[model samples]
Target chain A: MMQQERTKVILGVIGADCHAVGNKILEHVITAAGYEVVNLGVLVPQEDFVNAAIETDAKAILVASLYGHGEIDCRGLRGRCEEAGIGDILLYVGGNLVVGKTDFHEVKEKFLEMGYNRVYEPGVLLERVIEDLQQDLQERGLSRD
Target chain B: MELKNKKWTHDQFYAIRGEVLNQWPTGAAVDFAEAVKYHENIPAKKHFAKQLVKAKKNGRTLTQPRAGVALINEHINLLNFLRTEGEADLLPTTIDSYTRQNQYAEAENGIEESKRAGRSLLNGFPAVNHGVAGVRKVIESVNGPLQVRHGTPDARLLGEITLAGGYTAYEGGGISYNIPYAKSVSLEKTIYDWQYCDRLVGIYAEHGIEINREPFGPLTGTLVPPSVSHAVAIIEGILAAEQGVKNITLGYGQCGNLFQDIAAIKALEQLAEEYLNNHGYPDCVLTTVFHQWMGGFPQDEAKAFGVISWGAAAAALAKATKVIVKTPHEALGIPTKEANAQGLKTTRQLINMLADQPFPLSIEVQSEIDIIKAETRCILDKVYELGNGDFAQGTVAAFAAGVLDVPFAPSRYTLNKILPARDNHGAVRLFDIGNLPFTQDIIDFHQAKMNERAKAEGRNASFQMVIDDIYAISKGRLVGRPH
Candidate 1:
């Protein structure tokens, strides 16, 4: 029998952030999408993520946060990922990340500077994220569907 | 050395919170050490402290001193010194030395300690907690190795195990208006927050980590119970990418009839689970509070009955990943540390004692505990899903709709009487019915029992405030409504 296609997705909320709602949602969505998801739930520190990505040879790391202090909370995170040698993985983040409002472009620019593949707002159509992921998978010739 | 490492002389702690805490029936009076080992919530703390002061003033000879909050907060520096320096200092002046420091951590072996020993990070709550931080750090003790640095706590701990010191929403009194997450001051404020979400994600991405959801806010203490829409707004706001994110803590805790909270979370969890599973993600956490307001000690029989009944209900149908059982005395003033200790001790015991016992999740627990939980959830869910956040007016609507029988607001209906008068803003003024402060009687007895237990355990167990009366509820058949 032909093996079922699987994409190892290491998922968790990063930094000092502990929002479990979206983390759970992504788990539900991607598992159904036929990818193998390592559901690392909330309040996760940094090293665990890097270690998991390295251990599983994961294709992606999805981050979620709803607390306002994500800006200060998420400092020095990406460099750790690079140091851990998982720089080629697809990275996705969603949910409210900052405290006290500001501009989205600036937020996007900051994330880009730090090293992120894509970022999403709280209510990004899950379909869009899926579609983008699919395109990335297809380009890599790893698309299951 | 352990004895010598001790910081304070018992007399000082007794004087601070003792007079205020002795008004309850928590069993008997005990000492500071016993209070630390036992008790939970704010009221219990206050009552126990009061009891300790009374015992000392009366010249009661004690066996050993105790460790209480007032003592800990007042003399935090000394404890930290002993805890870090691994040495003891002189008497009297030593206590003064402990009190002199303003922080919880200094330096030891080049490592920094948390300052939570003195106070908490749970900021903004019931007018009383206005200045206090509801969040505190508790070092988690797990059975396995930490996934992070060697000798460090693991990050990939198993299902729903506690964090080294997770930040919990202290919902005693902070208003909904205070949170920066919602009630944005302007569109710019909202956009900036959204951007910040993106940056946080990248931080993790750089580290090959993924955040599912950051549970923020004061939980179920306010109106609107932080709906799915709010969750959606948050997601839409900042998170520009969600390759790995999953759940959010929008599913806050216990308040009024959980009909709405339960149903919404179930729908949201199921919905998100389905959506995320289809998208390739794990089922994330959806918080549901089974607890009600009023932790610590019960001020009166009615308040005690109410909180106890609520706790019993929480034990059965709490669908959340973890549940926090409120102490009986939360409605009163700030619980003495002794009281909080009691509650935590009980919680730990219950964790083990109730482990294998099957909580009738189905209908009929002799006392409609299961029914109330289920019925409340089902009706509330149907309404919320149908209402689509339109008819979402706290627990009032849900109760009127028959989804909930209990009112979330502090009103006369809870006691079967007329409601209170309103202020200019239409908010209820006097919160009376079940609002009684912690009593001295209960505090004293409970402390004594604790002291006795401590003594039996071969520890120095002395102090006037340790009341033994509090444990009555521990093994006492959950009378009046619980199973």
Candidate 2:
């Protein structure tokens, strides 16, 4: 009998936000779903995510920002990834991305242009992210069995 | 900050106004003189301050719901539905996340995107992005008076546009808005920004147009002991009064214990009045608002309604001037307009039924009131002493010294030392006092209450109790017990 390997990912809330409750919930859900999660806790900076992804040989970096400062904190992450020679690493950002009520499309587009692989609305279900990550890994030939 | 409690002089206020009004394009449209004229022409029934006074005089408790949408027409439709179907006596235009953070550019895009999407892209109404004319459209569409509700640390521009657009009431305070909502905003900066907001209200009052100001009372809203909330409310009330605010409502979130909830309302009203009178603002009118449980809600809609109905009962018996309704969809996320209306209608039914009966003044209730008052006095006395009679300066220092700690608040300025847990009856009592300026008697009183619960549960008071109590409501229990 053969078992599939669990995909490892780094998760955290970006910038000066300390919304620990949601971060903890996500950690619990992902771990229970058979994924390896390295949660950096809240108030994480760009370098922290980059270093952790490289250290763990992680496939993705999932960023959550609840304090509406995602635009400022998420900027230049793609550039930082390029500089760190890990630009191919998948980046996903979500949760109250901008301060006001902007269309999630525009938010997603802006983040995608800035190098994020996927962007989510504030209440987007974690299950969607899980499904997408599995598909992305399969497409990239990174899935283990 | 020298605690400039006096109303801002014309030079002081207008000087700041120039910069604040230039923050967004809409700010340029706020003509104060024109806005004052518009407010004067509004019918008395459509004025928030007038309606509140009438409710107080008529001895009726009003109900209000928090609802907002991104698009203009949808927002008006949602509010009208809440007004007619929900039976809300007062209406609110909760601001969107972008506007709350002063990101109007993104809010503008949100408005356009909401139009394209045929649904609200923003959670709340973006009044600032909508500008004065746009907000006036919302005002004209709704029948009842409207208030702006947002968790904004800096509401200077929002205050300018919303008030100019004829909103007669506003909710938030420097301390309440910043500590609970944002992790990194400086308290001193928020306090200064709010001073501008109060002064704007002051100018309106000077022109004989009154606006109602409410200080966000349930800081962090998780098991906040009454005294801690009361102290913050009184401080904010005093700050508003100094800026010529004539009508103020201090609010409290429901704590689930009937006796303690009722006692908190009673004590809040008394303390606000006493503090206002002593501070030489005797003419300032006072009222109370009870927020439905501000902590987590049970996911089951039926169970959520149970929580909602219980809050309505508490608000009615406590005689809060008004009750802020909570929806059945609360735990799920932003509720649909229908769900919001249902919550309001349910509250209306409960309050209407409970109106005829008087709140029972049991000995136990009186004892709760006494304990709340004593605890509040101990904190305020220390606050006053720390300020050396300067309340504002003392407030800054108190937060610095942890004398005014709010549980679970993200502000670094807070001492974060105090911890709260449920008593045997499910009332919130201090678990860890931190650096609160409580007398030995007050400390002993809280200790004994916790011990009662501890003894019953056969566990020593510890941080686990605090964590358990935080999630207790969502798990369908008031007191978290070990499984």
Candidate 3:
């Protein structure tokens, strides 16, 4: 059997949010699920995510905001990624994105509007994020395994 | 920039007000005089200050839940549900993040998008985006007092819009909102911004409108020692009072130790009154709000209810003027409205059951109270000394010198030098005092407390203990001991 190349992805909690537990858990889960994760720790800025994406040639940038300020930090990230010439890069964000009790569908729609390819709700199963990533990458013809 | 205890002059306030009102379109709609008129017409029952005063006099602990969504109608419906279903005594319109960051444009887009989708796109009520008219619609729909609960360091616009919209209470202070919530907000800047908020309240208070002001208590909501949070609340309360705020509700986050929780509340109310009186604000009405456990919750709903009920019992026993309830779905992301209601129901049941019970005054409880008071005095005296008797100035310098510290806080402005761990009895004690100015005896007290826990666990008092304690409650243990 031909050896398959590992799918690389960048993961982090973004922008002044130091929620390490979830980031650690996500990295472990994704790693165990057979993906190479470039864990950027916490408090990651937008440029750092983009730079890491280009540096690692990662297929996706998974952003987590556990402190309810995701919309501000994740806003215009897609545009910024495009400016960095990574427009087609898969963008995912979730976790208490806004401060108040917003509907998940509305949160999802807002992220989609902001150019995120997928937005996970807080407490969303890790397997779902992985399954969706696999399907999305396969659809984009980026899968090696 | 000198952090003195001086109220802003009308001209100075107007100069800042001009720029503030221009921050967003809603700013222009906030006619202070018109807002005053609207407030005057609002019934006494809907006034937060009046309700709080009544609760304090009656010795009843009011319950308030955190709930907000994007659309105005939905947010109103949610608050109404909390009022009827959750049995909340006070309601909160938690501001959305975009508005908290002053990103009114994005918040505006969120509101419109929410309307188009027939669902709330924003996480909060987007009070600024809603402006006065929209917020007034919410105020009109709600049956009781509504507060604007948000963690905005620069809440000048929010304060203006919400107060104008008939919100009777506003939660947050410069340090409380800044140190825990933001990463890079300077102490100097947040104090100044919060002065604007207090001054806005002052402006209303001057017009014979009593608005309740609360400082974000439970700083970082980790294993914060009582004295640490107490010192901050007293400072923020004095700051609010200096700005002419007559009604102050200082808050403390539940530390998961019952005796310590009761002691902290009693100490907070006593110290606030003492400090305000010494500062010549004899008229300042002091109240206490006990926030339910603000740290990690168990993933299980039943376990989460245990945490909520524990907090409720503590709040009731402490005779706190109000309790900020948490939902059973806390470990999860923002709770559904139903979950929020469930949390309030749990809290209501616990408080009501314990309502007839008086807080027991035991020898141990008395000692904890005395120790907490002494430690708080040490911290506050150092802060006052640092500011040369100016609380605001001292606060800035205190954080700069690490004389005051909050552990696990994200703000670079906070010293983050203090490390806290539960004692043998699960009371939060300082594991690392850092630059906190404490007497040698107080320092020894904390050390001895930790030593007792360490000896029991057969381990040295170390950072590992702090880490364990952080997750202990989630694991159904208070003291995180190694196997």
Candidate 4:
């Protein structure tokens, strides 16, 4: 019997944000759920995420922004991913995603319009994220064999 | 440059001071001789070290808040408001992020931008950009003693400007500021830079001026275990003492468990004194600071008050010299002055209520203290052995070998192998101990506590629990249980 290789996923806190707690948590939760987490750590650029996804053939890129500047930092990230030729790669973002208290529905709709596959409000459980990843991966036929 | 835990000679210090003071145009204003004279004229009541000594003698827990703004007059007014309306016992001049990064040019622009906008644009006071005279203006305007609260990895020029400007206390150590605050700064570099800062304080002490030096005790502040933080605090204390610093205040973040929080403070004070004395620095006056929960707070203002009050109760009961207050607007970005004062008043009320109430030294707290001591001793011993009795070398090696890992630290120097989670009662336990130099018995103790939580939650002891615990407090719970 041969062991199977884990499915690949990219994770990081996008832009000049240095919040590492949630990014580390995401890595742990995703890796424990049987995925090869390419943790980009904190203060990552938009290009790094797309480049990593393309290099590793990761099924998804989980971008986190906790410094409340995600609106500006994350702008046009999807178009950059498309230019890098991994536009279809799943993009999941969460955490204090806006400058102040905005309706979650509005925030979520805005991110979706920006081409993110999913947008999470602050305090969403990691379990829910992992489940979403599994379902999304399966629907895209990118699930582990 | 070979880094060692030895004190720099006056010649060596002056040589570096020449360059350090030339970092920006503001640095040119730092005249050590004149500054010492100015410091001599500061009233004893407005002296940071003097006030802390008085607080310790009276068995009082002082309250301080984290605050600053871009402009000078606004910053002065803010500190005064916190002193009067908030009833903060101590005041802080928190430095802006650009200054923390040594980006004085950007800080200058921030000051200009703030002036044109008719409102402060920066998160904190740009002390370095303000220069000695500017800092002196704010220092002279504020009623109480002020401390420079910042996360600068290289605080050499900032230290010169602020100290010369009349701030009596400085916060952050090489290790404390670097590992948690920077992404790629080396331990050797930060530790070396911080030695210069400490030496300046020592020079002040030599001139009969005692300046308080605090090692930021809350590394990463997210689920950090007691032993890890304790080990870092003791190391930093010894490092400061080596540089001739005589007055040191070590700090610790609230871990949320009452017994554990109190035990941590007791263990930190005792361990710091022992290490400093054993290292041949017995004259150092040590104080302890309890930082109100450094993690996420509930978005609701009422719930935020509960968190702040709990932290105050812990600090008061622990009899720490002072408590760093947190605002109810914590969950929402930078707090308004009113919210900041409300947090301080809330903490003051709790401290006033709990001042006379004695927290019992129960068996649970004793056990926690004992465990923390043993675990901390193990790490310190390894650090010593790794350095061949040199703390500077030992610290760099400890992080490299994963012997002194801080959980969730962003430094490339640290191995970052440790993972912390809460147990059944919300006490932090290691899910993965990483390469921490803990004895088998200590490892077993943490594992058992983790196992108990797993059983209670009807879940396996895995990373899921760690995730849940991270957001538990913000969701208004201690232990994150399955719903």
Candidate 4 chain B worst ten-residue window by lDDT: B461-470
Tens-digit lDDT track of model 3 for B1-483: 565767887787888898888888888898888889999998988888889999999999999998888888899899999999999999999887667777788778878877886766566788987889999999999998999998887999888888988899999998988887776679889999999899889989999999999999987788889999999999999889888999999999999889999988998888889988998789998889999998878878899999999999999999999999999878766787899999999999999999999977787788989999999999999999999989989999999899988887767787777888999999999989999899999999989988898899899997667867877887777778898
- In the range B16-89, model 2's lDDT, one tens digit per residue, is 78899999988999999999999999898888888888888887999999988888888899999999888899
* Winner by TM-score: 4
Complex DockQ, candidate 2: 0.13
Judging by lDDT against the true structure, name the best candidate.
4
lDDT for residue B481 in candidate 1, whole number 0-100:
14
Compute the DockQ of candidate 3.
0.17
Candidate 4 per-residue lDDT over residues B198-266, each given as its tens digit: 999999999998899999999899989999999999999999999999999999999999999999999
Give Cα-based local distance difference scores for all models: 0.34, 0.86, 0.87, 0.89
Cα lDDT tens digits, model 1, B173-288, are 01111121121122222223223332333333334332223332222133222231233322221122232223233334333333433443344444444433443334433333
Task: List the candidate numbers ranked by DockQ, top first.
Answer: 4, 3, 2, 1
Best by DockQ: 4
**What are the runs in model 1 whose C-alpha is more than 4 Å off?**
A1-4, B1-483
Measured against the native two-chain assembly using Cα atoms, what DockQ does each of the candidate structures obtain, in the order listed?
A: 0.01, 0.13, 0.17, 0.26
Clashing residue pairs for model 2: A99-B97, A99-B98, A100-B98
List TM-score per model, in order: 0.32, 0.85, 0.87, 0.89
**What DockQ score does model 1 reach against the true complex?**
0.01
